[model samples]
Target: MEIVRGRSVLKRTAVGRLQYYEKEEPSVVRRQVEDTERELSRYERALEQAEKELEALYERALGEAGADSAAVFMGHRMLLKDEEYRNSVTRAITGERVNAAFAVETVGDELCRLFLEMEDEYLRARAADIRDVSDRLLRILEEEEKGGGRCGRGPALSEPVILAARDLAPSETVLLDKKKILGFVTEQGSANSHTAILARTMEIPALVSVPVAREWDGRLAAIDGEEGILYVDPDPETLERLKEKKARQEEAARLLLEIRDLPDVTRDGTRVELYANIGGPEDVEAVLGSRGAGVGLFRSEFLYLEKETYPTEDELFSAYRQTAERMGGREVVIRTLDIGADKTADYFGIEKEANPAMGFRALRICLKRPEIFHTQLRAIYRASAYGKVSVMFPMVASLWEVEEAKAMALQVREELEREGIPMGHVDLGIMIETPAAAILSGELAEKVDFFSIGTNDLTQYTLAADRQNDRLDDFYDPRHPAVLRLIAYVAENAQKAGIRAGICGELAADPSLTEVFLKMGIRELSVSPSFLLPLRKRIREICLEETENDQGV
Candidate 1:
């Protein structure tokens, strides 16, 4: 194979000349369904036999090598139980069928077509799941035919294995030995995908959306996930440089940890509250480990996404209480369910819309599902009694939405009181994400106790560009004049209202925007723990009077 390489996103899948576009008549569909059911039954029987054989292997391995070998065997069992993998096979069986010769090829072709048509990079890359499932199934079938009778060896575990995939499913990413996985290189993915988020949380280096990466088989490569760059087939000298760079990174990380305990202050004497944006209760440990000032934004959607059913009041209460208690006296701002059009809850059965981002989401979903919303409201209210808890509504567009949300919150509070449930008052806040919300900041300030500018959505809406679109990424500027203007408007309104305004968006963590945000009179800036000290130092360096004086310039 000629070594033709391109600088591409690691997660982009290869498109091949697979004939899946052939028209399927009604008869074909019926025949395919019947064949699929038979194939599924055959696989089920094979899977059963594989399980028995696996158990036998485990017993033999354990008898020979003790519990350590059995542990490795058990790990494979857990991997087999992965829901995403199981679901992929189920989907394949239910949706289409063909002879083994054509099944894998057809699935691959269909997945490629589906991926190409998808607008979201994250969803588009789901084609990889189809490929991964088919590949595994084909291997199992081949082994069975060859009378190998199920290969039982565990995956070759390595330290810092660069996971190269078309795209990683959540289950694959979650189950991977994070410590051993050095970095991830995918043909497709965005920063918001579960794999990307998990990699970031784990501090694993990752590069995504590399077009035609599968063609670069076994080529010497170097990647810096922190910088989102990949170096293909580096010479010895380049490899040496990378090694030096790695050493510097390790040293810098070590130094950062050493100084983490110190108060973030610059040459001057200004202080900034550096907080962490957390996903779940489990994230609280990491936040505390980093000595975060408080939980700035507790993404409550995690609870909704992880469970099959809506989180009950007591379950919600425990989660909120755990977070609050972990933070101790520090402020914890809990963002209400931000789910809407695109991110529908299976249990809620939210209808899919043409434009999910603009349609019912966040606070909008709560209005439709009052019972679910009320449960969350009650939990937040109850948790407030433990520590400082602020309830923030996301994607607030109109004064009516804010009013309705606040009224419902109060209703929940009243219901709790009538039942003699112990609860406390919470500071109500609105996320200024939409242009409508930003434009009406003065009006919104009147109703809400605080404002948090969500720059991610704000930038996207203002620029009229999908942030995930690589072609439109050039327009996703946080520093754009219009975006800055919206931030200024919200800050000015919050100042006039005499209520604190903060930023919990990705922009808040940006070192470049730290001074600009401070100049705009933002009182609090909540960022990831990694950015805390640098931001704190940046704040300390600026004199408030000098900042205010330089505002005109």
Candidate 2:
């Protein structure tokens, strides 16, 4: 067996025949054009067409991969409409008197090269986005010249196989039929690329930077994404070994499934609520499949991030209502518009910040822009009539922020009531993501109905480290004593105030600390839907009293 190694984005395994995906590279030959105006017009038309294509892809991705991954297309759309990029393309077309396709290719290549040379990996990963946009425009220009038809090679295989590629753009990754693709292997890509993000969202086995040969296209392959290894043309002995491993994995999955309908309880009968965190209504299926007790953290910013404009109250209501109805009476806690930081939209026109993670983001933006907050509150309140719904404010630090948000929510409810809009009782809550909030959780708990500890941000903010910066990976620790003490303190304050306290972050899904959290009187744990059953399995095996002796709780 020949072993290929790379960086793994998703920890899953798949065994299938290899299928080398041959993407059509656009040919942009430089040709002199006498009519500069016509060339410029052609470029504009191609840009518009590219934007439309990306919009449609965004919609498709929203349905297929949910909003978080789908947001890549919105970014693509923004890049297509970027004034600087457009100006560069136009300058080459008009001044150099070159073909629209050739100008686009030249400018796009230069931009990609510049981005790739950036110091930050996140910025460097954006080079793929530039290439994606450029290739899209080129294809549109080519298609228009040929009089209209779909471009690019569609899925070549009728059956699912290990998709091998040089690299995949977000557009190409989203366009492919996910069911017909078993997994992904790329010779050139970063772990943070959009293609990698989509793979994680799809929860499929994916390895990047693996040197793959076209000759192995039809060979039997087994990929272990957790190990970042791909076995090509595995020997009989190796195949048998992989099959046995696969069987064991499947058996473990089956065990998790068996407990899907079971309660979140320990061996000693102590119980806790287990819920799922979701981005949008599309994730309801996963929640239901995992039999989640409820949605503890419904990130509301995704609704705005995926749109070209601010979503209307009706639009917001429709999404929230759909999710709530699907959950079928289970509580759906929708966190109001946690925008900024890594999540942003062009329409918002938020200024570039030196450190956005700690700056004008989340509840700060909402409190400053009551019009936006009011619209969301109205929609959420209206949706509450359909099912069990709760509204939470994110990035809350002090009493004033919570008080102001609550006042605005109250005003919206009163407005809706006066307008004869039907609504239901919606619980008001706040996310204790900041250290200030956690330290003051007792007072904050008395003000809100619940407290959902956003451990992801809490950890970063407490540690004073940017979680997204890989350079600080060793320095940033969520399980640090300080973070744990803060979490336990929040739970204690929540218990004293007679309010529910839960965790809704990366730490919540960690099975190792499940017992500690239980011992701390944490009322709930919210994680991605995929982790629900396995977390339940972990919880069922734990005894809180036994954990106290081991962890000094």
Give the alpha-carbon lDDT of every model: 0.66, 0.86
Model 1 poorest 10 in a row by lDDT: 18-27
In terms of TM-score, which candidate is strongest? 2
Whole-model lDDT, candidate 2?
0.86
**Can you give the lDDT of residue 113 in candidate 2?**
95
Question: Which regions of candidate 2 are displaced past 4 Å?
Answer: 1-5, 17-24, 110-125, 146-155, 158-160, 176-180, 187-193, 209-220, 232-236, 417-422, 462-485, 545-553
- What lDDT score goes with residue 14 in model 1? 23
For residues 1-553, write the lDDT of model 2, one tens digit per residue.
8998888877778889999987877777889999999999999899878878888888877776776678778778877877779999999998999999999999999999987887654466567778888988898999999898785334566899989988887777777777788788998766656678777766678998899789988899998876889999889997888778778877987888889889988988988899998889888998898888999999889888777799999999999999999999999999999888777787888885656777789999998998999899989999999999999999998999989999998999998899999998999999989999998998898899999999889999899876765456567799999999999999999999899999998789878898788888996999977789889999999887776767776
- Residue 30 of model 1, lDDT score: 19
TM-score of 2: 0.86
Best by lDDT: 2
Error of 1 at 102 (Å): 8.5
Q: How does each model score on TM-score? A: 0.74, 0.86
